[model samples]
Target: MKPQLLPRKSPRQARSKALVTAILDATAQVLVERGYAGSSTNLIASRAGVSIGSVYQYFPNKDSLIAALRERHATDLYDTLDAVLTRRNPQSLEEKLSAIVHGWMLAHQLEPDLHRVVEQEFPFFERAHQDQIPIYRTIVERVRQLLEEHREQLLPDNLDLATWMVLQTIESLIHAATTTTPLPVHQPAAIEQQIVEMLTRYLQVVNPR
Candidate 1:
């Protein structure tokens, strides 16, 4: 067999990626300190130590910067999630759900700033459908696959509905737990327990008592 060839990134593409990364790093720092309204191109340029002209060379406006940053934030989360999901062993459905939830919580705790900026500041760009829909759809599909694997245990007809319901519930709970303020003293344990309880109640097949 001929050697499989990996497509190589052009030098221009590589440089563009570097510039975009620098701009995004600068934007995140500014957003943390100054809030969305104050994150101007000049400030981002100054923080990145790049020329204002250079900043505009890649990102046409501040909105473009925010959009790129938001996409990067999502991409980072998805990448981390992919790693966790890959390592998970085939096991009880409850164990799988717990593993996924724990990984999500850990990721949120580690990158709360990026999470806040993405949640609060990023606008829905033209490419949002292209970018975001696939991520959600993939999550739904994974849940559906897991349910299929354990179909004998679950109500057969409601698999898709259950998958979507479980996904939405977990996502909403995580967002609330991570984003809520007046930070709770027992937040870490509280969130974990809440996730386990919610999922167990929804997924368990015990007949009504």
Candidate 2:
């Protein structure tokens, strides 16, 4: 049987929301410091400064909290990228690529440790959120739409496949640069420039800059 990997209830009131946020924040810290094996509701509750009962009041167990944490992290990232991608300001494809790569890196930079842990355990969290729209799909669809806007300038005939390749390439490079140390491109500015240039070339931008 599948474990109950969801909150027992949603926190609606401001106070309840704050309490839940505290719990998830503690969960992230604990997961970062101790990893999934070492984490537990007891440790999370203590870290959150809440009673175990209070923890159980919302989350059924530690896994549920981790799931919630991952969900929140994914939502926050999607929102950040969505805002950047959906903005009305006109931009060349290269400019859009730069903004998106930087935005993704910036979001991960804010919580690098937690991002690493949650992403490593994504399969588990992925299962927990199976009923909902995947965040990655939403971001990809948005980027694909951006590509559709400039199809004439792009080389790939299939924008859908091209979008996937582009996003996966950007995500893999940025994820490695942020989560792993001693990368070839260690600085954020350098990484962003390299990625934008790389994707622009791969997409065969009509007029190379």
Candidate 3:
């Protein structure tokens, strides 16, 4: 049997969307201020200036609310990355890698708190969360494509390994940059350049003159 789908929203859907957004925004504020243990549906409702029943009408429980918020945060990050990657055309390998790293760092800076909530508090809704394998796969595929286009300059038989290494290294750098305490002494551009340099050294196949 086919699975049942949820009903489509009508004109009232706009209002519902706005209400849900308000609740999620309020929830984020509360979560950052008081942590997970202190944030409750009642508090979210009060802060959102909506009825408690209204909050329940949208989110059945705290876990559901948080799961939705996590999804939203991920979608927003992806959208920003997409825009940056779409707009840039780097003339050289170094320029391309720098663009990618800078784009990622900018996205992280744009939503550090949301990223923190997802990375730190998202485990509570493990079952609700989706796998990020596709995200990593896409990054690797893009790197591989770029490498292939520059085969004359850097021909590596193991493109898969190169792509994986670059993706993993950049991912770890961003995660560390976002989570580190007391923050690092270096500026954002310095950090981005550092990541770009490290990845380029590992992935770039040197051609002996």
* C-alpha lDDT values of all predictions: 0.68, 0.80, 0.69
Models ranked on TM-score: 2, 1, 3
Q: Record all residue pairs in model 3 with backbone atoms less than 3 Å apart, i.e. clashing.
A: none
> Model 1 over residues 1-209: C-alpha lDDT tens digits?
42211112212787777876787799888988887777798999999989998876767777767766655555655666667777876387777777777767766676577667667765544333432545545655777887787767665468878877777687667867787452475677677777877877777754432
**Deviation in Å, model 2, residue 159 alpha carbon:** 2.2
Residue 102 CA displacement from its true place in model 1, Å: 1.0
**Model 3: per-residue lDDT, tens digit, 1-209?**
32111112212577787888898898888887777778898999999999999877767777667766766655665666667667886867777777777777766776577667656775455522344334544555676787777666664567777766676687668867876441464677777888988876666647534
Query: Which candidate, 1 or 2, would have the higher lDDT against the true structure?
Result: 2
Q: Candidate 1: global Cα-lDDT? A: 0.68
Considering every candidate listed, which one attains the maximal lDDT? 2
Candidate 2: clashing pairs of residues: none
Candidate 3 TM-score versus the reference: 0.73
Per TM-score, the best of the predicted structures is: 2
By the TM-score metric, which is better: model 1 or model 3? 1
